[model samples]
Target: MTRPVATKVAFEDGWKAADTITLDETARYRRRMVMTSDNGVEFLLDLGEARLLRHGDGLVLDDGRVIEVHAAPEKLYRVAAQDPHHMLRLAWHLGNRHCPSQIMEDCMLIRRDHTLRAMLEGLGAAVTEIEAAFDPEGGAYGESHGQHGHHHGHHHD
Candidate 1:
């Protein structure tokens, strides 16, 4: 039976659609959702069941669950991008998604983090230190050099 599709997402600060969202067809779910509105804001999103099937080019859920779409990945992506709660529920199920109350805490931590990381990078800490704050484990941290820290960067590595 198709489980009832309850609210899959709840924004911390009631974000306007089209701001921090993007769709992923082959991934079988919402790809990039910048979790802002709470406080500090971070670019991270939960993965939905839509991505749980083939287990190949799928989204590795925030819960550390790998879900690849074997059927209609694109349709599922539309469903997740249009609605946020269901996507958020996917995170809740993973046991990593934060609660409304914790939103503030997460924000505070993330903001301080970015600030410190920026400061560290500004102070000329090794590229590794800066990357650690933004992207740990030497993964694709991918930071675009910005002028005033706005999303837009004039120069990119």
Candidate 2:
């Protein structure tokens, strides 16, 4: 059977999805792939390049059906500094290590690692474990998944 093709994209509040595709951080980025929804609805996501799909982006099928993309929950570390200056310093260190981190206003989230945990603690940043959707910055040069692809206000609660 020819799977439904999703060519258009929608931001979180724009479209109501007929179904949802929960994907981990790694599986979310793709130019072409077959995805099966929770209800067993299968489709093709051909974005033409690897793009980071955030929690509420939708894939619009040719038949006007929408499949919402949800960021799957994962174990991560929440890091916070005592002050803004310290936070900036910690961010720099994480960036230097090429860590994939979700930079929030008050804290940052990264995949938990003992070495990284130790480093952050030594740097005077508090580290805590949390379970949430992991949506890190793509990079200096990365594909903008769709409209409002820039994750400005999206963060863990």
Candidate 3:
């Protein structure tokens, strides 16, 4: 069977996906991958380069089928600080440690780690354990192609 290559991403107005593909952050970035849908349909994810897929975005198959992407749930720590400055500092610390964190309006979300949790608590942050889909900042270069945005540059393979 010929595998379908997705050349476009649609945020809306696409055909309803017959099935969904739930993926974590690490597995979401890909140029080519063989994935099975929730309904057991096999398909190929062939893009221009390794790219991050977002929830609700439709993978436009060459055969006119659209596959929906879903962000898989993960264990995370929701860190909240007494003040905005403190929260910002915590974010900076996470960045310094090369940690992927999801920035929120009043809190920050990072993958749970005993050391990091202790550090956060030590810094006067209130850590709350939670399970949610992770969609962290993509860094300086990949920042443009954020959660729902598309990238147009070469990505290291």
Better of 1 and 2 by TM-score: 2
What is the TM-score (0 to 1) of candidate 3?
0.86
**Best candidate per lDDT, number?**
2
TM for candidate 1 is: 0.16
Once fitted onto the true fold, the runs of candidate 1 whose alpha carbons sit more than 4 angstroms away are 4-113, 125-157
Error of 2 at 97 (Å): 0.6
Rank order (by TM-score, best first): 2, 3, 1
TM-score of each: 0.16, 0.91, 0.86
Output the better candidate (1/3) by lDDT.
Answer: 3
* Candidate 2 residue-wise lDDT, 21-136, digit = tens: 89888888777887898789998888766677777788888889998888899999999999999999999999999999988889999999999999999999999999989988
Check candidate 2 and list the clashing pairs.
none
What lDDT does each candidate get? 0.25, 0.84, 0.78
Candidates 2 and 3: which is better by TM-score?
Answer: 2
RMSD of each: 19.9, 2.0, 6.0
Candidate order by decreasing lDDT: 2, 3, 1
How many Å off is the CA of 5 in candidate 2?
Answer: 0.8
